[model samples]
Target chain A: MAATNLSERRLARFWSKYGFVLAVLVPILLWFSIFSFGPILYALYASLTNTHSLDPSRARFVGLDNYISLLDDRRFLASMSNVFRFVLVKGILNIVLSLGLALLLERLRRGRNFYLFFIFMPVVISQVAVAMLFLWLYDPRLGLINYLLSLVEIPPQSFIRSTAQAIYSVAIADVWKTYGYAAVIFLAGLLDIPQDYYEAAKVDGATRLQTLWRVTLPLLKNPLVLVMVLIVIDGVQHFTMVQVMTGGGPADSTLMPSILVYNYGLGANNYRMGYACAISFIMFVVIMAITVFQLRLFRSLYD
Target chain B: MTDISLDRRAGGSLPSGGAGADARIRLREQVIALVTHLLLVIFAFIAFGAMMWMVLASFKSASEIIAKPPTFLPEAPTLESYALILREQAFGRFFLNSIFVALPSVLLILFSSSIAGFVFAKFDFPAKEVIFTIILSTLMVPPAVTLLPLFRLVSRLGWADTYQALIIPVCVSAFGIFLLRQFMEGLPSELLDAGRIDGASNWWIYRHIVLPLSVSALSALAIFSFLANWDSYLWPLVIIYEEKMRTLPLGLAYLLGWSSRPRYDLFLTGAVITVVPVVVFYSFFQSRFVRGVTLTGLKY
Candidate 1:
């Protein structure tokens, strides 16, 4: 009887300890199953059928039709190419400028935080507000940018007005808005390089520029890749700036897939939910591919 | 840039006659330093010029804001636009809606993720690794992919256009869970073991031991989650159509068209209201903000 009682007490203590862990873990897993996992599965199903969002049960399957039509869509094609163009040009500029700024900032031992505070100031604010301010700046008649151009005796160029200029204009605004993030990340990376590397470079009497080119940039591969991946993500997901500034055009010139997906999926009176899901899935593939590729490259290079 | 620095460090090592070359290099470095300062000043101007321009423009009359050559300062400063925005534009309602959505969203995210992260980090359970991997992989699915179906589910639950619609779907993030989990793994296991040894329950361990020790990470995630929800545009834009349900960013965007006129003063004013508080808060706690963002990039 005594042995049986002791065994029962040991079993009860075992349950109490491990059981508590399950209690915490179980709810979260269930929540994810319902919210996150369930929705993705539902999205896969929605993409295969013409599902009205309000009445998803009334959907009928029409596989591959949405994807096929998407291939034929002019606006979608334009938006894809536009995003690629924007990402390529803007991505390069952002990386170069942010790296330059990071190097310059690393050189400064004083007033470093002050400059970072302002450079990062724009990014911390809402993108909508930034777009609004740029609206003032890009205005033809009374804008500050045009006024400055006039002072230089250059003709006032219409920004965010013509189709050709619109995408570049929005891209520049976005680069300016977000370059600080890349700069700071680069700064963090620059800071992490051991002093021995610099000292050894100094012993070799390597010029600062050469040392930077050889030592700093080479070691900076991971952060650079990280910055590139982030910029790619931001570029692919570009929406609010485009929406607030151009609304995808003077003529769909600045259209991004993000805004496109949004308009089709959830815009007023246009509930082509199935088609939108297809578009979203395609973009998801592209994003995941880029992220995985870059990350693998970075990991191989760094580790 | 390189010459002057070396000279300073190795000045004593140089012979006395090399002083002339050193001075020349010094002058060169001075010129370079001066140029750097000038460029930085210009950068400062470029960085903050537009924002400051908006603030000054906010105080100006509509005509003055658009005046030729543009007024540098308000000829006559007024709160007229602020008053109108608050009274007519329903700015108060939108601000409250943002707070309503953001506060609960952060609270729920913090609550669930911290508890979940603690267990995932400390516990040895069945299929824990596989389940954790599944949750983390879900981070790759962009919100766009989930938006339509999530909307269907939300509307089905009778949450459309309500604050719950905004809060519930977004209250959970794989990224938050992942971030907290990484932080939790770094925590010392001894404190938790001690708590357990003292007959403290798992809830007690998380609440009393883990939560206090992980305060910094939690604060970072707190500010992060709040700002993300506050700045969220897409999902809220889709779900909330009612004027009363709109958040600050959406309200400001709506004013771009919905205003009787473009109303530069009013537009700038609304933009200022939407952007300034968060920016100002961040400026004061700038270190915390940077740490949070950097953690996102540097950590998993």
Candidate 2:
């Protein structure tokens, strides 16, 4: 009876602790379960169905047809190609430009904050606004790029209006808007390296370029991977700029996967809900795969 | 701050009181530094030049803006673009919509994530590790993948175009909880011990002790949450259907319009409207913002 009584008291104490844990965890869990996890699960299910309308309950299961159909979809194919191009070009520019700018900023004695403010300003602005801003900058006749080109004695080029140049133009605008963020992140990483390392390198009579290659780059491995991963994930989700500035224009040149999904699932004349989900999942798998590959590639290189 | 000094010393820019060889090396280093300085200055101007161009264009007449060589400066600067957008277009409505969606979403994430962080940091409960890991693992689930079902889920809840649709789905961030927990881990547990020993309720301890101590993290997360929600595009674009309900980004996108005609000046003005305030706000808390990005790197 005494042992039974002790066990009962233990149970009560367990309940009290569980109560506190539940109070905090339940809301977030409920939120995640309902909004995040549930929806993703729902998306998986919907991908197998022909759910065109908003009411997903009415969706009829069509097996793997939606997935199969996406394989042959021309626009979807175009979007994937666009995504690969974007990831490649944007990825290279981010690392090179940001690292270069960060090194330069690190070397500067004054006006670091001012430089940061201007560079990082685009990041704070909504993508919609940036897209709109660039639309003007990419204007065929009067845009900033062409105007600058003319001043250099080069003929004005129809940037976004031309089919061949449209996607690259869009990508360039995006690179400009986002590279500042990479620079800032790299700068932070640079700042955290112990100053003593530099002094030691100085004592050894190392050149700035040599020391940077041997010391700074090596020290920056983690931050570099982090920056690369972050940029990849963010870049792969490219939609707004394509949508607003070009709208996958000049013959579907800039139609990214996200834009493709939005177009199919939500565009006025197109509402292939089932197919959209399938495409989204395809893109999801692609993003995850690239992320894993990037991390492993960096690990092999540095570690 | 150390970056500057370390770089100077590393380059041997300041002579170490030496002979002919050292002086030549210093001169070479000085020349390199000068070149680097010139390059950075040019880059800075070009970087900030985008904003300068936008602001200048916003002040120019439509004809003046698209002139052959283009007006570098507005010869007769006017506020007509601003007036046109605000009065004729629905710029003001879209601006308010963004605030409405962003503010609530930011606040909700802060309150829930902070409290959750506190609990995760302090409490020893059943399944704590497993549960925390589950939450952390889901952080990588891209929003793009969930777009379809989320839209349907919002539709089912009868909140398709409402601000609630925007607020509810994004209100809880796994990343935010994880970040705050990392912060709370550094707090001396004894800091809350006094409150606990005094027979105060857990809520009271969390509110009076944990919340106050976690202000720095909270503020950092606040900026992140706010900026993130403000800059968000696809979700708002998909969820919202009504014209007046459009957020700033959506409005700016539509200003490009489905039509062939381009209105550069007004579009630039609208862009400025959406961008200026957030940039100004960020300027005030620049250090916090930098620290926030750095903390994100450590998440790896």
Which residue pairs come into collision in candidate 2?
none
- DockQ for all candidate structures vs. native: 0.45, 0.53
Question: Model 2, stretches more than 4 Å misplaced?
Answer: A1-11, A55-58, A196-208, B1-22, B298-300
- Residue B241's C-alpha lDDT in candidate 2? 81
Q: Give one digit per residue, the lDDT tens place, for model 1 in A91-198.
A: 988998889887777666578777777787877888888888888889887788999999999998889988888888998999888888888778877776766778
Candidate 1's interface RMSD, please?
5.3
State the lDDT of candidate 2 residue by residue for A1-303, as single tens digits: 999999999999877767777878888899999988888888888889998845456778899999899889899899888888877888888789889999888877777877777777776667777788788887777687877787789998888888788878888888888887788778877876777788888899999888999899989988788888887787777777878878887788888888888888988877878888898888788878988998999889888
Worst 10 residues of 2 chain B by lDDT: B1-10
Residue A12 lDDT in candidate 1: 91
What C-alpha lDDT does candidate 2 achieve relative to the native structure? 0.81
Candidate 1 CAPRI-style tier? acceptable
Model-by-model lDDT, in order?
A: 0.81, 0.81
Clashing pairs in 1: none
TM-score of only chain B in every candidate structure = 0.88, 0.90
TM-score of every candidate: 0.92, 0.93
